[model samples]
Target: MTTVVVADDQGLVREGLELVLTARGCDVVGVAADGREAVEVVRRTLPDVVLMDVRMPVMDGIAATGEITRSGLPSRVLVLTTYDLDAYVYGALRAGADGFLLKATPPDRLVAGIDTVAAGEALLAPSLTRRLIEHHVRGPAPVVGRPAALAGLTEREHEVFLLIAQGLANDEIAEALVVSSATVKTHVNRILAKLGTRSRVELVVLAYESGAVRPGGA
Candidate 1:
């Protein structure tokens, strides 16, 4: 079963998410009312996925996400927020969140988002991707440091990374590159392994940071 940790300040929201996810056959391992507690729970439980709310008292989701990722935890974070245009989305993404979703998202999509991130895929909505790029561009250039983690990728793997950063799904990428979906999946797997990233969301961040693909280059 896919184990999940839910962190939200609101009791109702947390409970509702837990109920919905559990009903979908996911294991709701734990829930936290604040970011700090959430981080602690994650450290102890090591759940497969974390459904994190962006706003919380004592170390908001962004900071917790950074800490969780820097600590090299096994869990993937999926950020939940009420404001679509909130600047925190970009921060959380840079902090290593695997995906961002609106709190009002439908139950089916929310469940799918969890599964997507669990499968090492990024879950940015098509509409949200454009906004995310715009948000990043409007902010500072994020220091643009190159990490040696990207050194192991092959040319085709690099191509796949660019396509993924552009928000192309596996099928679309396969069609674009004239390769089978299975081949695209293989390339993506290699990309993730070489970069030491848990999901495609991290790949997108690396792609932008490496200048392999620009924000509007999509």
Candidate 2:
């Protein structure tokens, strides 16, 4: 079973998620009402996925996610917020959240998202990708030239990087590059290693923030 830690300031939200997740056969290992407690629970339980809330007392979800990521824990975080356009979404992803989902998301989708992240797959939906980039990417776009972090990538890896930032699946990238999915996966792994990113969502945030990809795909 996929193990999960649910963190929300509201008690009802945590209980509801646990109920739904448990009903779906997920292992709701732990729950927390604050980011600090959430981090402690995560460190102790080391669940497969953490359902983090953006707004929390003590420490915000973004900081908690950053600490968890920098600690090199195997657990992945999937941020849950009440608003799709929450201001903290970009920060959470930059802090190593594997994906973001609104509280209104159906229980089935939420459970499926946990499974995806537990399986080491990115749960970044295309719509979330567009909204995040469009909303947060402002001021002078850095897409004009390559970001220094990407300089280490080989030509193929760079292609994969850009495609990943564009929210393309491995199969889609393979098709676009006229390569096999295995090849794409290999390229993706290399890109992730070179960029020191835990997942594609982080790379996506990197690409957008570094101006590697412009809003509106310009």
Candidate 3:
């Protein structure tokens, strides 16, 4: 079962989420009323996932997510937002949230999202992923050259990384590349290792940031 921490300033929402997640067989390890408390709980409990609210007292989810990720903990953060296109959602993503779910997401989807993030795969809603990509692509270009870390990836690994950043799953990437799924998985593992990224979400960020995958390119 996935282990999780629910963080929201509202007591009702936090309790409701804990109940739902528990009923779904998830171990709700902790719950917090603010980002700071959430961070502390997560650090102590070391849950597999954090159900984070975007808006909260004492640091907000974005800052808390950044702190958790930068600490190199094994936990992954899944941000919860009430808006489909909330501007803060993008900030949370950059702060290393593995994915996000709308506050109105169905119970099943919420549980599934927790599982996906815990297992180290990305869990973006398709439309939200597209919006995020567009936001990055339209931003001002980086003045510096490609990130130096990317130099370690092989040509095949680079190809796999681009497909992953485009929101394709391992199976989909395998099919598109006409390779076995195992091969695709191996490529993905190598890509992550070479990039020193803990999860696919970070890989996506690096791909776009390094210009390996552009706005309107193949």
TM-score of each: 0.71, 0.69, 0.69
Candidate 2 ranges beyond 4 A from true positions:
135-218
**Full ranking by lDDT:** 2, 3, 1
RMSD of each: 5.1, 4.4, 4.5
Assess candidate 2 and give its lDDT: 0.84
Q: What lDDT score belongs to each candidate, Candidate 1 first?
A: 0.83, 0.84, 0.83
Q: Give the best candidate by TM-score.
A: 1
Clash numbers, per candidate: 0, 2, 0
Task: Tally clashes: model 2.
Answer: 2
Please estimate how well model 1 matches the true structure, expressed as its whole-model Cα lDDT: 0.83
Please write out the lDDT profile of model 3 over residues 1-218, one tens digit for every residue. Answer: 88999999999999999999999899999999999999999999999999999889887998999999999988999998787764776788789888888888899878877876787777776557667777766777743666887777888888898888887767678889999977987898888888889767667767777777776653
- Output the TM-score of candidate 1: 0.71
Residue 150's lDDT within candidate 3 is 79
Worst 10 residues of 1 by lDDT: 137-146
Per-residue lDDT tens digits for candidate 2, residues 1-218, read 99999999999888999999999999999999989999999999999999999889999888999999999999999998876664576787689888887787789878877886787777776667777666657545555666777888888887888888888777778999999977887888888888888877678778888877766672
Model 1 per-residue lDDT at 121: 72
